[model samples]
Target: MDNTAKSAAILNGRLAEETTRRFTERTFRIFNDADHLSHLASKWKNVAADKAQGHMFEQLETIKFNYDALRKDSELFAKTTASMVLGTDPVDIIISDGKKTLREVQAKSCNHAAASTFALSDKKYAEMMRLSPSDQHAEIEKLLKQRIAAGTLKAGDYEQTLRNLKKDLQYDNVSSGGTTYQQATEATNQSVADRVADEFRVKSALTDMHESGKRAGNMGAAVAGGISAISEGFALFKGEKELGEVTVNIVLASAKGYATGYAVTALSKGVTHTASYYLGTGVASTLARSNAPVAIASGVVNASKSMIAFMQGEIDAEQLSDEISHTAITSTASFYYGAVGQAIIPIPVVGALVGAGVGYFIGNMIHQSGLLALGDSAVVKAAKAHRKQVEAMCLAAIPEIQRHRHEMEQMLSQHFAERKAHFTDAFSAMDAALYEWEPDNFMTGLTVINDQFGGVLPFKNFSEFDAFMKSDEALEF
Candidate 1:
């Protein structure tokens, strides 16, 4: 295929991918929320359960962020397990680039602002040594302060420096194998300190991720803009669009997409919130936990887009109506299918996502088929053919029209310059005659004036000049 066709195909594919991903992502989130509700109902009173819930939330967030990064940005590959075996792995998540490990992430949902109060232990200290140097230093400082407060070490006994403390504790750089009594004690202290630092890091990461996720409209806008830019870039490469047009299109598309996404998200949330007040928490929560909101939001956004396109004269009224109807039907189908999917699959979130996806796919296929049938109609075909003919004729005449315009401009400019020069010369001569009061100067002025009239002056002497002035053939006053 040509670049034009290829670029169009890729753009369409991207649009489809975005729609599917949005639906499925929203579906999964709803189910995840439902799971949280179930937990709250059953184990709300248990402190341990609350802790477990927090941990699970952190883990899920980490997995989701990594998964999105991989899918959207094509970043490093992450090996994530839904279930983790306790004591089997020290890290909560491992990230690689297909060839080598990039990072070992330890997820924690603890409050970062709180001071570490866990007692120092030998095994913990050893683990602290495995962390980066900055982390190790920070942990050691905290531990030393704790020990000093407890009166285990005199304030003057050791300098607060990491090097001094390590030396005094008989600490070695080794992470594994043979441990002395002093080393073990120091290691134990370091481990507890390490926990404090690790929690801080995890919490910091989670906070940033949460903040980013909360700006869903901005993210959606960016994604849409980026996709448009890529598509336009392809067109630029194919000489189908100029740089200025592409830039403007990208900016406008981003702004429009952002407004639509933001409005839809806000409106959907508002509707759900308002419903909760009237329907009670239980009913509202159930409604909030379903795919209906996502479907409705998507449909509204799509319909708005169609309306905009129609207003811009990009589509006819019939096409606009069809698009709105298609969006409504598809959205309705997906919402109901999601419920059926959950019932059939008996999985927490997987079934709903799969079912909604299937529903959307079927709806889209039918919509496209209907559009194709409409396009093949006689009136539509004739309109298209007429448009093509007009476009071809315009293209053919453009060069000739431009050529004529350029020639006319040049001719007008030349004529203007010539006339201006003649007027300037005549005026200057007349001024010189008036100032000098001499026959030679007057004659020069008259000669210049005669030249202006194509040398048509009829007299050379005073008598002929008087007769010429008196005669009807003379120039009118």
Candidate 2:
């Protein structure tokens, strides 16, 4: 790497960083919904401009009319009803006009219907609703006792309390339960709550899960916001679209259709250097991209700028999948200097070795770390662990099988992020090497770096990653 190229490399790195910063700062709106994209939204307005649009508008008008009519009709004729599950009445309604009293069934229908919906009318109905305890008529008391004895009414407990119940019937030696109004009310409330809880099967575990998910979802919004800002910042900075020089031309990712974005550049033809090694981040401000945050957001970025955010975020999802770490990663800037550096190097064989330079970089990268790529043995353990862990997570879900779903999700978060970050690093590292660090005697460099010991790397650390894949070992609530 010559001084001029180093300067150019640094400058190009700064430009890439500027692109990423612009991307982040420009996107990540908290209130913004990610699912909404201009491509989709634009279609809605475009309908009116074409034959399709005009037809859509007419259809929409009909739908709008139907909606309004349906709502109006529902409001006019329908009653807003909630489930009113009453514990079978302990006492029957009584009727009295300060004179004779009569026992009434526990219902609210009158002899005649009224025009007002949800409201009943009939002087007899009005008179029946206002019965007082003093009315204490004998006939009502007899019916109440008969109903209780016959088990026609399931709960006599509430009606038995003389103090708690406001009755129109006289208790001719009928009031014998020691109950007060307040106690009766409390018991009633408790009974209702118990019934409701039973109906929904609302146990503690489900409650906790629901709340945890809700909280995580809320926090995820903040995460989403932060991601958006970083995305936008990168975009804004890269608005100039100054094409970067191809520093390393690694194997074109013939990765079947869509595995693109694998080119690299070290030295922009015209730019001033500011640092020892400038690292290119991502483009696309406001990115609706695959979660490649590990590549641009962590130690993978300008290793010199900030490591904590990138590193933490990289491993964040690795906890989800270890490939995250294996595929995408961090390597020194010196590790991937391709043709551009060779261009500036001007070492004895310049034009004679033009094709060889690119070829050598690719072959060396493949022989080295690239051999330990995604499907490699090192990543096998982590991958298996992640698969089983996720499967165990789903399998354990049933008629309330496992209690520690939280722990499962945590494990998921760690492994998923790990896998994502790992792959991001690995794949990117290949390109970086091809373009940024074209080492002399590529094969020697590959062999030296290939077998070297590193963090037992998440890809190789399978035991802990896949420890919980059995039903027998599952946690109990």
Candidate 3:
């Protein structure tokens, strides 16, 4: 094969691999959720069938939401990957010169029928349109008044429902004359349209910032980590055994190391928390995408940074007393960055924090190495004693932890009797929902590939595309 064909084939293989990886991750998330909800359903088994069914439905919805998310991301990944392979600027692929963007492509993508019709109004537009002008106007006023009356909304606030409604109507050439039916009717229509458009615009801006932040956080963390690693490696290579002679030196270094190591982690966690209050693509998958690289950078930088910070006197040794070993263990654990290690704390932010705590462990290890190399003085002995105390306390907590675990297990058994059928049904339904989208997802990905090559694919339509994807050659992938 020619170089171009070989490159194209290689890109195709990569895209396929990436898509499968994404799909598997999403599937695991969906099933993990299904399992959790299944446990919840079992707990609620004593409750009414309707309540149990509600939990079951929630499990199904989680599966569908995650499945669709996977498809969308996979298609986006494919588009970007194809653009790169085809020598098109992938970053600008969504909006090339005088072209419709990824948003337009998404709208046109082959997909399932939506369960609900798109409404132009936030209100019951269909039902409201049936009413006379005066009634329609009254309904609009009622909604506004209801919102204002509720403590949740304020009349004077710029984004307040009532305030925005008045402004939208007036801006749209629809007078809000209190007594006129015609004016009220026009105002009602204008309000809904304006509100929806404004919401979409606001949401889009926030989404872009959030997505940009995800990449930025990863880059920042990676850079800091890389620098730290290089510096530390150089020190170790030179046989520089002592991090610092004084306690003040060690503390400053530990702080600086932590800052470098967790910079991306902190930003990613912060952005994720803030974005949760709004709408966006999401944080979980993006974080997952960058975790391995971030982890490696974090671990290396953290070790080096802590040692350097101590030598530079950024941290006081006084601050290092009694906490060296704990710090060492915690730092190491936090920066370890294994999927299974973080799995115990499902919430990424919490997991990161826990991991951060574990970083102290690494710091302590470094401190011990320094103490041994530089000769243990009074300060070092005190620090060592503190570390021993910390270890003793941790060992003392084991029995209590085991007792708590036993009690929790016994309690769970009480609520989980004879509920295997319900769990099976929920999981089966989730799998079925996911399967329905699989074909469309494959076609969508192929469409992106074809578009990237400027219609170079053998297929002329979706049917042909589908056939091509299902062939033995494609299946071999």
Candidate 4:
């Protein structure tokens, strides 16, 4: 192959590897890491007992369903979004009327064949074969159209299926058995269609926000995250029949923080614009920059409020420390990247990329400096002590977590058996009726490992998680 072709092949191979890695990396971590296994096991033990065990297993099933559903929904969302962007309709199913296309289906299913639905059984098939060639073709066409009109058969993606009422739909042979006589069938795949619609709305909203002249990167992140939070929150409510106070609190807090941060950033940008236009470039211009002051004030006020609440016995010290660290890190990052660094770049698309890269580097440097300066603070010391305590607690729970793994698996097995009883098809039985305790993919593997193991993973937070994930051992795993 030529150099260009060789380069393309190499990149394609890398893309495949990355995709595979994304799906399998979590499983690798859970299976190989003792700490993660123990933590998961502990969680399972706490929840997986008696009547509650069934619900816990169901949650696992829901998670697996969510993963597959999300992947499919995401693909559909992308296709639909692309079509919208390009000013075209998404066509997945179509009907051809002999000489030309009869219909391009964008909806969940076509209702063109709603009049008559029939499937030929084994006896009916034998009788059908006795008919002459012309008679057989005519009968088959009539039956097929009836089925199509009734939405009885799987039309499949974009393949041309004959739907002409004027001519005979030709086929080499007619084979029939089992449910050939389709009377009335409810929409079997509407759930997937509904999920795709939900994803489409989220994608559309994000696109709308981006087109509305907001900074594309920031707007994209906020919109996507906000939509996801809403979707997940709704799912939890629907599944559990009740929302937890802690869950609600966390969601509200996140939303509040995001809004506050956005306001601060926008106000800073406005101030920067005014200063640049009136004050001109100098020491005055530098001093006039709004991000540093706004960010610092925002962080201090939020963090200090939590800290003061803790001192007054209104909240725990751990919660206060978390607020402090979170505010400090986030505000520091925003100040550098969103404000100071972004101002240096003027190009739209290219400038965003350049600004983000420079901003992250500057942000990291400032964060490290700030951390060192604040090392002597009581909150910092408390956070460190709390971390140690958490680690010790997790380590101590390992054996108990290990014990619960088998119990959880037994619960899952029962759950699976009950579901299997409702299905006759082996494939369907395997798909929905069975739950694997030891899955090869990340999400299930993590769930299983934590349920079986006594303690959680050793990683302190996302930074540690990242470090471990990028390690040589992780790659090999």
Candidate 3 ranges beyond 4 A from true positions: 1-296, 299-329, 336-341, 355-380, 383-477
Of 1 and 2, the candidate ranking higher by TM-score = 1
Q: Which has the greatest TM-score?
A: 1
Provide backbone clash counts, one per model. 5, 87, 29, 21
Residue runs of model 4 more than 4 Å from their true location after superposition: 1-294, 304-322, 337-345, 348-373, 376-477
Ranked candidates (lDDT, high to low): 1, 3, 4, 2
Candidates 1 and 2 compared: the better one by lDDT is 1
lDDT of each: 0.48, 0.29, 0.37, 0.36
The lowest-lDDT stretch of 10 consecutive residues in candidate 3 is: 107-116
- What tens-digit string does per-residue lDDT give for candidate 3 at 1-477? 111211121122112222233343433343344344435444555665433333333222233333344434332211221223433321211211123332211100001111011111223221111111222333454654654567443333312322223211111122212122322222223333244334433343243334333334443344434444555656756877444533344344444433432343333333432443243334444543434323433333343444555668875564333233333333333445333335667764455444444443444455555542234434567778999999899899989999999999987775454344444554555455468755444445455545544665455556776777777765432
Give me the displacement of residue 183 in model 4, in angstroms: 87
For candidate 2, the lDDT comes to 0.29
Instruction: List TM-scores for all candidates, in order.
Output: 0.33, 0.16, 0.21, 0.24
Model 1, residue 71: C-alpha shift (Å)? 30
Stronger candidate by lDDT (2 vs 4): 4
Off by over 4 Å in 2: 1-204, 240-477
Model 3, CA-based lDDT: 0.37
Worst 10 residues of 2 by lDDT: 75-84
Candidate 1 Cα RMSD (Å): 25.5
